[model samples]
Structures are given as C-alpha cells and as structure tokens.
Target: MSGDAVLDLAREGIWVMIIIGAPVMVVGLLVGVVIALFQALTQIQEMTLVFVPKILAIFVTLLLSLPFMGAILSGYMARIADMIVTGG
Candidate 1:
C-alpha cells in the first residue's frame, strides 16, 4: 500500500477504535464522577466505593453498544479486506 493509503487506514482504525470505545468510557466516567460526588457529599471516602458502580455502568454500556461496535469493526474489516484484495 502507498504511504497515504496506509496513513488513511491507520486514521480510520483510530477513529473506529474511538467510536467503539466512547460509549463505555463515557458511562464509566459519568459513574465515577457521580460516585465521587456522592462520596464527597455524604463524606463516605471509601476507596473501593468507586469500582462496582463504574464497572456495572461500563458493562451495561458495553452490552448495549455491542452490536454497534461489532458493526463498526465489521465495516472496518471489510474495508481492510477490500484494500488487501485490491492491492491498494
């Protein structure tokens, strides 16, 4: 592949990675912030208090977004395959 095509593919892969990961990461961040706020307001500064909810939220987000992620990955793979076949 040409340098330009390689760079374009790399850029696209990065975008796909971001798109696939954004939902889970966002949910996790929101959950962590909320938990931190709760801890602050209630004065419950337990170190392990943050993990469960954040994990659960991230898990649910991933489950909900699984199909979308799969579609994105499949589309990327198809493009990669096409490029390989075409020797681009």
Candidate 2:
C-alpha cells in the first residue's frame, strides 16, 4: 500500500481504539471525580479509597457495554480486513 493508505489505516485504528475505550474510560473518570469530591468534602484522605470503586465501576460498565464494544470492534476489524484484502 502507499503511504497515504498506511496513514489512513493507522488513523482508523486509533479512532476505533478511542471509540471502543471511551465508554469505560468516561465512566471511570466520572466515578473517580465523584469519589474525589466526596473524599475532599469528608476530609477522608485514604490512598486506597480511590481505586476500588473506580475499578468496580469500570468493571460494571464494561460488563454492561460488552456487546456494544464487541460490535464496534468487530465492525472495525472487518473493515480493516476488507481494506487490506482490497489493497486500499
């Protein structure tokens, strides 16, 4: 493939990664922010307090979003594979 085709594939790969990861990351960020706020308001400065809830929240979100994530990834992979086969 040409340089432009390679670059296009790379860009699509990055976008797929972002799309696949965004929901879980966004959920974790929201949870972490809320937890941080709570800790600040309560003056509870436990170092470990930040991790467990975020982990659980992210896990739960992943579970909930698994099908959607799988579909997106599958579609991207299929498109990429097709592009490769067609020498795009």
Candidate 3:
C-alpha cells in the first residue's frame, strides 16, 4: 500500500477504536462521578463503592450496545477485507 493509504488506514483504525470505546468510557465516567457524589453526600468513603456500580453499568451498556458495536466492527472488517482483496 502507498504511504498515504497506510496512514489513512491507520487513522481509520484509530477512529474505529475510539468510536467503539467511547460509550463504555462515557458510561464509566458518569457512573464514577455519580458514585463519587453519592459517597460525598452520604459520607460513606468506601473504597470499593464505585467499582461495582461502574462495572455493572459498563457491562449493561456493553450488552445494550453490542449489536451496534458489532455492526460497526463488521463493516470495518469488510472494508479491510476488500482492501486486502484489492491489494490496496
């Protein structure tokens, strides 16, 4: 592949990675902030308090987003395969 094509592919790979990870990251951040606020308000200060809910929320978000994520990845893979077949 030409250098430009390689760079473009690399850029696309990074974009796809970010797109796939964004939802989980956002959910984790929100859950963590909410948990932190609750702990602050309730004065719980439990070290592990944020983990469970964050994990659960992330897990559920992943579950709910699985289909959409799969479609995106599948489309990316198809494009990669086409590039390979075309010797791009």
Q: What local lDDT does model 1 show for residue 88?
A: 95
Question: For residues 1-88, what per-residue lDDT tens digits would candidate 1 score against the true structure?
Answer: 9999999999999999999989988898899999999999999989999998888888888888999999999999999999999999
Global lDDT of each model?
0.94, 0.92, 0.93
Q: What is the lDDT of residue 78 in candidate 3?
A: 96
lDDT for residue 32 in candidate 2, whole number 0-100: 93
The window of 10 residues in a row where model 2 has the poorest summed lDDT is 79-88
Alpha-carbon RMSD, each predicted model: 0.6, 1.2, 0.7
Angstrom error at residue 50, model 1: 0.7
The per-prediction tally of clashing pairs is: 0, 0, 0
Candidate 1 TM-score versus the reference: 0.97
Off by over 4 Å in 1: none
Error of 1 at 25 (Å): 0.6
TM-score of every candidate relative to the true structure: 0.97, 0.89, 0.96
TM-score head-to-head 1 vs 2, winner? 1
Off by over 4 Å in 3: none
lDDT by residue (1-88, candidate 3, tens digit) is 8999989988998999999999999999999999999999999989988889999999999999999899988998899899999999
lDDT of 1: 0.94
Off by over 4 Å in 2: none
